[model samples]
Target: MNKLLVITVLVALLALSAESFRMPRQAEEDQGTLTKITDAVKTYYTDAVNTVSGYVDSVKGLQLEEKAKTLYTDTTNVMSTYAGILQDQLYHIFYHN
Candidate 1:
């Protein structure tokens, strides 16, 4: 009868509404996961850049006089520090970060 058909349609509509509401919760969880991953990547990249910049500044600060002895010593020290920094950064980027 007419009442039976109307009741059936209302039940179907209610089921569809329930499904629609659940979908938004699933979508929000997925979006939050993506945001967390993006933020982690951003933080790693920023730390790597800052560490590299510091190494560059330290090397640039090394100034030796006209004598080759002082220049050689300074260069050796700066090169060792630079190498260590680069190694640490690469390790983080590849393994940790």
Candidate 2:
């Protein structure tokens, strides 16, 4: 009867220890799932930032191109006006003299 009591106590202790050990494994799996979710969120935000930055840079480049074209057109018009004035002056000097 004493031996039966000892065996029963031992079985109960072993069962409790097994359950304690399994709890840590469950906690570790939960932690791993949380880490995966965190990494996915970080990647999504990083990609979104990169896309927005690229779009902003493209818009800036287009604005600069428009400004450059306007400056070029203004310069061309000024040169044309100057050339026309010079031709008129040369014709007057040659024909009126």
Candidate 3:
């Protein structure tokens, strides 16, 4: 009976030790996924800025200052949208867990 009790305690300790290792492995994976998402968002924002720059140049070339101003305002709106998406993703990743 004493030998059986000792074996049971050892088994439980081993199980918990295994679980400790598993938790950090899962956390590392989650961090990697979050990093990828952040990188993609940065790329998208860069592309958006480039598009606005090109549009401004084209509008200026055509002597359409009013249209250029409107496009600039629209570009600002798009940047705000991107900012909102980034904030939501950060909240979901950091707080939802």
Candidate 4:
């Protein structure tokens, strides 16, 4: 939405600049400059959109099994660590008393 708005504004500016009260040659020159700017902006946004879309597609293409394995490993490791800590505390309080 924001990108569209910016493009719209740039087009509007280009139109306005083309009808400037300046001399004919200057008007033509200004139109060329504005056209170049609009083209550059369009190219930049097109590349950016394509890059982001590619990233999203890559993420979506990930194997669910890989993600599940990672999550499972992380959770198991955390649980084991916490269990060890609790066991140590309990041993010191109940057995070492």
Candidate 5:
């Protein structure tokens, strides 16, 4: 009887040890998941606010004009050059050639 009792206790200990090494329990993982969800929601709201403000600025035709000009002038220049080249090529193909 004593030997049987000892065997049962040993089996219980082994089962608990195996469980300790298993995947994270639901409650523990849930806190991390909840924090990630909260951060995502905050990021989404911030982006939404920025978008709405941009639209409001557009109604005044003032979507941060100076900032846009400073940031986009180089890009605009590159695009304009490419467009001019394309136009020249098209003109030659259809009219000049």
Candidate 6:
């Protein structure tokens, strides 16, 4: 009877130790999954920020292009007016002299 009791106690202790080891493995797996989820979220946000920044830069470039075109047109008009005035003055001097 004493031998049977000792055997039973040894079996119970072994089972408890096995369960304790398994719990730690389960916790480690859960922690790994959480880490992966966090990294994915960070990547998604970083991509989103980059996309928005690109769009803003595109819009600014288009605005600058429009301003450049307007300035070019205004400069051309001023040059044409100056040329016309000079031509009129030269024609009057040559004819009236």
lDDT of each: 0.70, 0.75, 0.74, 0.81, 0.71, 0.75
TM-score against truth, every candidate = 0.35, 0.39, 0.35, 0.44, 0.32, 0.39
How do the residues 1-97 of candidate 4 rate in per-residue lDDT, one tens digit apiece? Answer: 9989987898796685464456545544455666777778779889999999999888879877799999999999999999999999999999884
Cα distance off (Å), candidate 2, residue 51: 12
**Model 6 lDDT-worst window of ten:** 13-22
Superposed Cα deviation of residue 9, candidate 5 (Å): 46
- lDDT tens digits, residues 1-97, model 3? 9989967765654454343444646555454544555556558769999999999998779878778899999999999999999999999999996
lDDT of 5 by residue, 12-66 (tens): 5445434244676555445554455555655876999999999897866864777
Error of 4 at 63 (Å): 4.4
Model 3: ten consecutive residues of lowest lDDT: 13-22
Best by TM-score: 4
Off by over 4 Å in 4: 1-31, 63-74, 77-97
Which residue ranges in model 2 land beyond 4 Å of their true spot? 1-62
Cα error, residue 27 of model 3, in Å, equals: 16
Candidate 6 similarity to native, TM-score? 0.39
Between candidates 1 and 6, which one is better according to TM-score?
6
Model 1, clash count? 0
Model 5 RMSD in Å is 18.8
What's the lDDT for residue 75 in model 4?
100
| Best of the two (1, 5) by TM-score | 1
**Candidate that would win on lDDT:** 4
- The residue-by-residue lDDT of candidate 6 on 10-85, one tens digit each, is 5654454343444646555454544555556558769999999999999997898889999999999999999999
**Model 6 bad stretches (over 4 Å):** 1-62
lDDT of 1 at 38: 53
| Global CA lDDT computed for model 6 | 0.75
Clash pairs for candidate 1: none
Q: What is the lDDT of residue 95 in candidate 2?
A: 98
